[model samples]
Target: MALVKVQRAAQITLPRQIKDAAHLAEGDYLEAELTSEGILLRPVSIGSREPSPEQETEILAVVDQERKAYAAEHHR
Candidate 1:
């Protein structure tokens, strides 16, 4: 349904719609597998360690921005 071109480092950026549908974020982790059908990507959350203060701050800022955007769209 969607197409993505692989970049120089064999990296592909998921489209915004796909990312939102999967509830994925910038720092989220994913598991990749080669299945019988095709490549499969599964989002995985492995909390190995706590985020640094700066990372936490950046995450909170992103969350706040997304919340505001959602609220505006939903008239909340």
Candidate 2:
């Protein structure tokens, strides 16, 4: 297995071997999940009209974060 480091801003650069084996390319999208073992990433195709479940989850997460931030700032 290849090893990778989480960089600043929580970004990770996939190793060349891993990218080649997975047929990943720039502009490709991946769905990330937390499993019992570790983080899981799977390549997914997104439709132009409909958002994938993973994307919806990500959107909700972002909305939740923004709402909390706004509430904190406005309340104080």
Candidate 3:
């Protein structure tokens, strides 16, 4: 497994090998989830229209909020 460091703001830089293997590029969208084993990351293709950076940030924020809510409900 490739090791990656979480930088400031909880950002991670994907290793070159992983990027090439996954065929990921700059501006590509990824869907992340908290799974039983660990965090899962998958590439997301939104048809032909790619969201702007601001939109992507907003989407991720909403996702994070939902994830936190779910975890809170289940962890009690």
Candidate 4:
């Protein structure tokens, strides 16, 4: 187990060991979730942005339409 200290700004410097273990780099995006156990930090893909549910549905609908079109085009 590693120990971390919170700085004056309430920011904690992630230990080098932890960073290396997590394969984290500068400018990397992380998602933090607080739970009863502790804080969970997950590294996310760079440039990943959350989309609203409506946007997600729209995106999926577009993909489904494209796939159907492609299947229809290739069908015998």
TM-score of each: 0.61, 0.61, 0.65, 0.55
Candidate 1 per-residue C-alpha lDDT over 1-76 given as tens digits, one digit per residue, 9 for 90 to 100 = 8999976434689999999999988878667778999999998765633567887788679767866775687675
Can you tell me which runs of candidate 3 are displaced by over 4 Å?
49-76
Clashes of each: 0, 0, 0, 0
| Better model by TM-score: candidate 1 vs candidate 2 | 2
Q: Scored by Cα lDDT, where does model 4 land?
A: 0.73
lDDT of each: 0.78, 0.79, 0.81, 0.73
- Report model 3's TM-score to 2 decimal places: 0.65
* Runs of candidate 4 exceeding 4 Å displacement: 48-76
What lDDT score is found at residue 47 in candidate 1? Answer: 66
The per-prediction CA RMSD against the true structure, in angstroms, equals: 13.5, 6.9, 4.8, 17.0
Q: After superposition, how far is residue 25 of candidate 4 from its true place, in Å?
A: 0.7
Residue 29, model 1: Cα distance from true site in angstroms: 0.9
Q: Which of the two, 1 or 4, has more TM-score?
A: 1
Tens digits of per-residue lDDT, candidate 3, 1-76, equal 9899976445699999989999998878778889999999998886544687888788889868876886787679
* Candidate number with the higher TM-score (3 or 4): 3
* Candidate 2 lowest-lDDT run of ten: 44-53
